[model samples]
Structures are given as C-alpha cells and as structure tokens.
Target: MGNRTIIPFGPQHPVLPEPIHLDLVLDDETVVEAIPSIGYIHRGLEKLVEKKDYLQYTYVAERICGICSFMHGMGYCMSVESIMGVEIPERAAFLRTMWAELSRLQSHFLWMGLLADAFGFESLFMHAWRVRERILDIFEQTTGGRVIFSVCDIGGVRKDANAQALDKILSVMDTLEAETKELTQVFLNDSSVKHRTCGLGMLSGQDAIALGAVGPMARASGVDLDMRKLGYAAYGKLSFEPVVETAGDCYARTAVRIREIFQSIDLIRQCVRLMPEGDVIVKVKGNPDGEYFTRLEQPRGEVIYYSKANGTKFLDRVRVRTPTFANIPALLETLKGCTLADVPVLILTIDPCISCTER
Candidate 1:
C-alpha cells in the first residue's frame, strides 16, 4: 500500500469565501477521505431569541448570512406567522415571491463569479459579479439595503415597490438577462472550465438521496426535489420546473445553477406582470404560543426554520437547519477519490455557506 498523508485545508484558504476546515487524507495526491470541521464563526444568533422580542428579532434573523439575509428573515417570520395563525395578504405574498427571485439571481451570480475565480478565469469572474451588482442595485432601490434587507417582517414585507420602481426592475431584468446569458455561455461552453469541472466529484442519485443533499447539489445528481414545489410564497401560482442534471459531477452542479439564474429572471417577470393591487402587509396581533416549522427554498438549498413560543413576546427557542449543513455529508462523499488539486472546486460546487451553516 502507498503511504498515506493527512493535509489540513481551509479555516483560512485563498479559494474559500468563508471558513471551513477539512483534514484531507491523501495517498499520492489522491484524496482517500476528508474530515470536515466547522463552527469557527458561530455567533449564537439562534440563542438570542430569548433576549429579543419576536417582532424585533427580524433584524437579527437577517444577519445570519449576508448572502441569504432576506430569506433568513422571511423564513423566521413565516415560522412565527404560522404559529400565530396569521395569513399575509395576497399582494404581500406576490411581493415576497418577487424579492425571493431577485435574491436567487444575485446569489447565483455571486456563485458563478466565485466559481470562475476558482478556475482562474479572472475576467469571467468580474463579468459575473458585474451582473450581480445590478440585482443589488435593485434591492437598494426597493428595500433600502443591498445585503441585509430588513424589509421582511412578521405579517408581510415592510417595503413596497412603486410603479416606477417596478418599471425600473423590469428594465434592469431585461438588461441583465442579455448580459448574463453571454456570461454563462463561457461557463457552459469553455473548454477549460469543462476540463476542470466535468466528470469530477461524481455523486450518484441514490448516494445524494442517502446523504440528504438539497438544492442544486441534489438536483444535479438527478434527485428531483425542490422545496419550492411545496407551494410556499406564491410558488404554486407560478409555472416552472426545477433544473436537473443527471451527471452528478461538478459541471452538472454548475449547469444547474446557471439555468436557475434564468429561471429566477422568468419568475421575477411573472411576479411583476401578475402582481395584485392591495396592501403589502397585514396587522399581526398577539404573540405566538405554539411551536412551528417553516421551510423555504433558499439559493443554496432548502432551509428549515423552527420556532417555539410560550405566549410571550420572547420566543423559547429558534433553530435553523441550513442547506450547507445538510450538504456536508454529500460534499464529503464527493471528495473521495478526487485529486488534491480539485478540492477547492469540489467544495465550491456545493456552494458552501459556512456562515449560514454555523449560525
């Protein structure tokens, strides 16, 4: 047998956007096993539910991760709203759906840029992030914040897009669709990109299911599961299908995310065209007295929010099951047999959001 060596990766790596350490067991540059360690940046945000009132905790929830901030706040509010039996207005639901799609767009663009950077395609990375900037601009114009948008509230969203704002959103979407299509073509067609990603980190459908992979990670492995199909937040009213790829490799995951960017654009257009005329928020009275679970399709994957209340403004418990946590097993599975040089790309394929996972 060849001699085995253990190499420590991450917690501070040039490729990783967040901290995630992996002890890679290798035999002559081929990874035989990988051990992951997280929690370097855990902030105990979940435990703050006891100190912060349920209403005031919206801002705290949004701080779980800057990339998925709006969805974090939205998910927490949905859990409390379910416990309180509060039904948001139809217009509010539509607006939430629109904003959620925009969030997805910005996130996928960010991922594309990071992926390009990992592959050493600096120009491609800049182009992808340039497209992302437009989406953030839209967020700032509507919600007053680019990253941690505190607009998502208990009953509904706090902000509404006026007619002019909505028009600008559509105009920007049109421009982005054209620019993003060009940017994604390089990722899809470039020989170098395919060489680095294609056929690397293979995970079968059964293995993905067994490992509890979610979002694009699972979908790329041919497991047809999207939490949006649960009909939460006006998804039932929209017509679309989840993007799936059967290869179960790094390229497949990249392709799934690329297609999802277009899907988000289409969903946003549908929301703008079909938005109803009514209040964006409804009056939510009284504190929650029951335990509830809420699930939503975040950009990374399916995230679950659990809240337990004791009929007081302060919640007894608040817990989040982030997608990065769910996909770690699948990630470890993919790491086996891959060359050490491919480690960063494999990790990026899962789109590891360490902040969200550790929070």
Candidate 2:
C-alpha cells in the first residue's frame, strides 16, 4: 500500500456536476482504490408508487433523473403496461421511439459539453451546449418540456406530433447534425484532446464485462450489449447498431458517445419516416395485479424497472436499477492506478447521474 493516504472527492466538487463522494486511497498522487458513496440526493421517488395511483406514477418516474426522465417514465409505463396487458397504439410506439432517440441525442450532447468543461476546454464546452439547445428546442416544441417531459403515459404518449411536425423534427435534426460535425471532428482529431484522454483510465473488454458495465461504458470496452437490440418499442422496426470502440479508455468512451449522437439522429430520422397516422394513446383500463420487469437503454446504460401491484390502483412496490449504480464497480476499477488529476474525467466517462443512481 506504500503509506496510502485517504482523500474525499465529492459531495461537492467543481469538476463533478452531480453530488457523489468517492473515498480515494492515494499513494503519492496515484489512486490505489476508490470507494464510492452516493445517497446525497435520494428523493424516494420509487416509493411514491405506494401513494400515487398507477396512472399517476409516471410523472414521479420522470422525476427520477432530469437528464433521463423520459426513459425512466417510459420504463415504468412499459412495466405497468406489461402487467395490465395493454397494447399501446402503433403510432404511439413510433412516436415513443422518436422521442427516445431525441432524448439520447440531447444527453450525449450534454455529456460532451461536460467532458469538455472537465478538460478546461471552455470553448468546446460552449459549442457543445449550443448545439444541445437545438435538441432541447425541438423537445419543447413537441413535448413541452426541456428536461422532464411529461409526455409518456401508461398506454401511450399524451401528445402526438403530426406529419408536418415530424417533418420539422427531421429538418431540425439535419441542421443539428451539420453544425455538430466540425465540433465532433475537433474532439476526435485534436492532438491536445487526444493527449489528455487517449490512454487514461483504461478498462479492458473482459474487465468491463466482468464488472457488469452497460451502455457506452460497456460499448467502449467492446462489450456489445444494448437493451434496444431486444426489440422493445418501435426499435424492432428501425435499423441501427450500437456504437462500439475496442480501446476501453477515456478516449474510447468519448468516441462511443460521439458516434452514438449521430446514431440517435439517424434513428430519429428513421422513426419520423416510418411514423404512421393513428391515435397516440389507447384507453388504459384495470389495475395492475401482478409484477413485471421492464428494461430500457438509457443514455448512461441499461435501466431496469420492476413494478409489483396487488390488484389495486396504487402499486405495491417499484424498484429501479439505474445504469450508474451498475457502473460504480467499473468506476472503482478505473480509478485504481490513475493519477489524482484524472479522476474527474474518468468519472465523467461513465456519465454518472447521481440523481438516477440514488433514486
């Protein structure tokens, strides 16, 4: 251990946008181990299922994590729908997929900005956020919320975008794609950025799989596991593949997300093209009497939602397994042997969302 000293990194830190405490054991400036501590912002949102009616809990689900609210709500709704034997309208499925891709696009953009900010590239950070605002504008125009969109419901979505609106969304995505290309090139090709990230905090493919990593973290490590491939929602109708990088380092993680942004844009365009004219929501009836487990591919990773009902309006139990929670073990592993200065960027690579983790 070489006379290890302990340092607490978080609960409040400039580089960390969310609150998470890591007890780092350091030997001269190299981190030997990192013990993560969360729960600083647990709101007990899952427990709200006991108090709120099943139909009303979708809103609470959306509040679990602002960055991933739409997916959270969708997961809960999917679980309840599974239990209730409700088949959502075809049009609603396509719309949900479109919105999900939009959410992914916005999330990756936010992560890119945060990563840039962490590396002290202020101009890159600003440019990333500027592009992200266009995605948010599309959300507001269609779903009426920038972050916690209350559009997803049990049987289907509450709002519907007409053909013209869908066309507009596609146009907006094209514009965003054109504007982001130069920024993406700079991130991937710039020598300074490469020097800062290329080999730092490496996790091999086998290690990532053994550590139960998911989403881009696992994908970056060459573990080809995407819950979307399971054909939930309208993803079965779309043609896309998960973005994977074999390097499994900070740079590879960045590359995975950058590629995923373009993938999401392509997915949104496909969903809009395949959208059919029909009702967005079907009538949802009956109490959820059994249990169902639903999985969703959030921007961070795979999120599992479990819902149990005792033949009542209010659900008996709701449990969520967030991506960050699963990634913590991988986070701890990546921290080992890395220099103290690189800790924040390593943490950002997993795209930790403490609100989602602790919820």
TM-score of each: 0.99, 0.98
How big is the RMSD of model 2? 1.0
Can you list the residue pairs that collide in candidate 2? none
Q: What TM-score does structure 1 among the candidates reach?
A: 0.99
How displaced is residue 216 in candidate 1, in Å? 0.3
User: Residue 57: error of model 1 in Å?
Assistant: 1.3
**Cα RMSD for predicted model 1:** 0.8
Q: What is the alpha-carbon lDDT of model 2 when measured against the actual structure?
A: 0.91
Tell how far residue 311 is off in model 1, in angstroms.
0.5
Candidate 2, residues 186-255: lDDT per residue as tens digits?
Answer: 8899999988899988899999989999999999999999999999999999999989999999999999
Best by lDDT: 1
Instruction: Kindly state the number of residue pairs that clash in model 2.
Output: 0
